[model samples]
Target: MLFDAGTWSLITDVLAAVFILAGAFLTFAAGIGALRFPSLLARMHAVTKPQVLGLILLLIGLSLRVRSWSAVAMLALVVAFQLLTAPVGAHLVSRAGFRTGKVDESELQPNQMEPDDDEHTA
Candidate 1:
């Protein structure tokens, strides 16, 4: 046989466990940020960045355990779509939140906000 079933099984399990734990941690952090953040924009930042990454990690880990080229390819496609969309979606949501005055500017650094038009007086 080209492979030892028992050893390979153990290795696969270990890898899966590690991936799951990391994904769980990332998701947990996102949840905490969402709950603890002072504004919608901050919460959006948490979800769009860490949550997306966590999901990608979880999907990749599951694909590795599947050990099939097709599955990995599908997972890669999903990850690619997520990478392309999550940030854009988050940006739209943040802009909506800002326009709606749902965000609290006091929590953010002053420099992060654009200079006021009144401040640009000639």
Candidate 2:
């Protein structure tokens, strides 16, 4: 049996709300982490991770509300693009920060870096 307009509207509204709330929460958490993190790399992690997820959630919510194949396909494309770009963007940011000496070595543990090999080189 097909759902009536009223029921379909209610269901769509509820799903949309859920997706929006989840996306908002993810974005808020990312913002908090970016603010609170001690290092640039850490902040990059927070922003990249949650931003992608949040966008995906928001897109999914929008797709559900629209209830059309084209909308869903567009949302899927958006999700795919984000997934492909977010990590590469984060890596580029982190690498740039590292190269520019923007990141504090003191914030990272000594063991995290490779050991000196002067003896082996000699």
Q: Pick the candidate with the highest lDDT.
A: 2
Candidate 1 regions exceeding 4 Å error are 1-5, 106-122
Residues 1-122 of candidate 2 have per-residue lDDT tens digits of: 59998999999989998998899899999999999998899999899998789888888888888889988998899899899988998999999999999998878767746767885697
Predicted candidate 1 versus true structure: per-residue lDDT over 8-112, tens digit per residue: 887887888788788888989999999998678878988878899898879867986888999999999999999999999999989888889887777767775
Which runs of model 2 end up more than 4 angstroms from their true locations? 2-5, 109-122
Least lDDT summed over 10 consecutive residues: which range in candidate 1?
104-113
Q: TM-score, each model?
A: 0.78, 0.79
The clash number for model 2 is 0
